[model samples]
Target: MTQRHIIRRVRGVDTSDGAGVKLKRVIGQPALDTLDPFLLLDEFRSDEAGDYIEGFPEHPHRGFETVTYMLAGRMRHKDNHGNTGDLGPGSVQWMTAGRGILHSEMPRQEEGLMWGFQLWVNLPAADKMTAPRYQDIDPSAIPVVHPATGVTARVIAGELAGVEGAVRGVATAPVYLDLSLEPHAAFDVPLPEGHAGFAYVFDGASAQVAGQELARGDLGAFSRIGDTVSLRAGDAATRLLIVAARPLDEPVARYGPFVMNTPEQIHEAIADFRAGKF
Candidate 1:
């Protein structure tokens, strides 16, 4: 018999505006300890232009990585390293805030309706100040594999169905996948051993895990998942982001966008960013 992976249903969060934009946080703002190895999660969903019109202005970050995964609409981003571009639906941008860097991202082309998830993954103390880099992944470039029974998976940062995403600069050994399961269909996803992962349903529908139901914006963490985790979609089907990260088992001392092992290092990162050293 397979042991059930009992998971706690942690609802998405809602927070105030920052970064010169109106941000409704989905995670990481209030519940810091809820998800170890992960930091922030922002859901920029808006159909009104005024809500996301301002967007995020130039800001500095250090010791962490910010991943922007777009669901709908577009985002124009630019960084101090002289790199600039935009991201449409299914596009992604991962920025490593090692040492320090300044960047900005604003909505584009939608008049509104910018839906995306910006995740913050913490780096181990030893690698916190390594260096900064960015990886822009296009939707078409990311492979989408369909298994039997209407199960679809988008390979973002790890192996899936023998296909993989081209996203480099990921140190967390994390596996990010966008999964969609048809009604009445089921999926058995295999996660690496000793890893921690969660699923955030976003299809506004219901999903069943060993008969337990979960709604949209509801996050579930498997406390004791085996190599494989089972999922079954409801009548309306299920859509969610399945994220798994390798446990770092290291010290985490974070301050704002910077994550380090010591407060002084965080202070130094800020000072360097201000002093143009990073």
Candidate 2:
């Protein structure tokens, strides 16, 4: 029998990021601590242009991967590696800042709603200094599936009902799914045994998880004892992002844009970035 993972905690996302852009930070806050192999999850949703216009200026990152998924508006990104791309609605950009990278993400539109999520996944010790890479995925390339009546899923990094996601070759073996459930609908997703998992509710009211209610803009971090997660929609429809990943279980040394295994490594990353070695 599959054990239903219970929601161990529920918390709100009230934070700001990248030049004053208001965002709902579901996972990276100090209160929640850190989920191994997954460092951060920030959701930015705003209709006012002033809220996001400043955007994320050029920044340096190392020893991790950043995954950006846009649901609305447009964002253009440029990296020091001469790679440039635009992210439209439903698009995804998975960047590996393995060794190091300097990049900027700025909004393309002056007005209108700009909504999206950015997730930071930590790399293992052996792969921390590997070369950077990217997986630029268009909306059309992402596979969508109707797993059951009134339920829709967009697979981003794992297989759902045998429908594979576009992202591949990730070290963490992550499962990222964008899910929508109608009123009173129920969905159960099987996860790899022992992987850490969580869900962030973005739209609608509540989700019933193991008999507990998780409200909007709230994150539900699951207990590690279950092989499957079960959720039931409230009276209204609900939209959420669910993710699971194998834990690295390694020491974490973080400073600003760098995440390394030791304080000495973080120092090296800073030195390399300042010396223009990225």
TM-score of each: 0.93, 0.97
List all candidate RMSDs to the true structure. Answer: 2.0, 1.2
Give the alpha carbon lDDT tens digit for every residue of 235-258 in model 1.
777898888787677777776766
Flag regions of model 2 displaced more than 4 Å: none
- Compute the lDDT of residue 42 as modeled in candidate 2: 85
lDDT of each: 0.77, 0.88
Number of the top candidate by TM-score? 2
**Residue-wise C-alpha lDDT for candidate 2, range 1-278, written one tens digit per residue:** 47655545757557777798888776778766678888888889999998899999999999999999999999999999999999999999999999999999999999999999999999999999999999999999999998878889999988898989989899999999999999999978878888888888888878886566778877777777777788789789999888988899999999989999999999999899989999
Output the lDDT of residue 6, model 2. 57
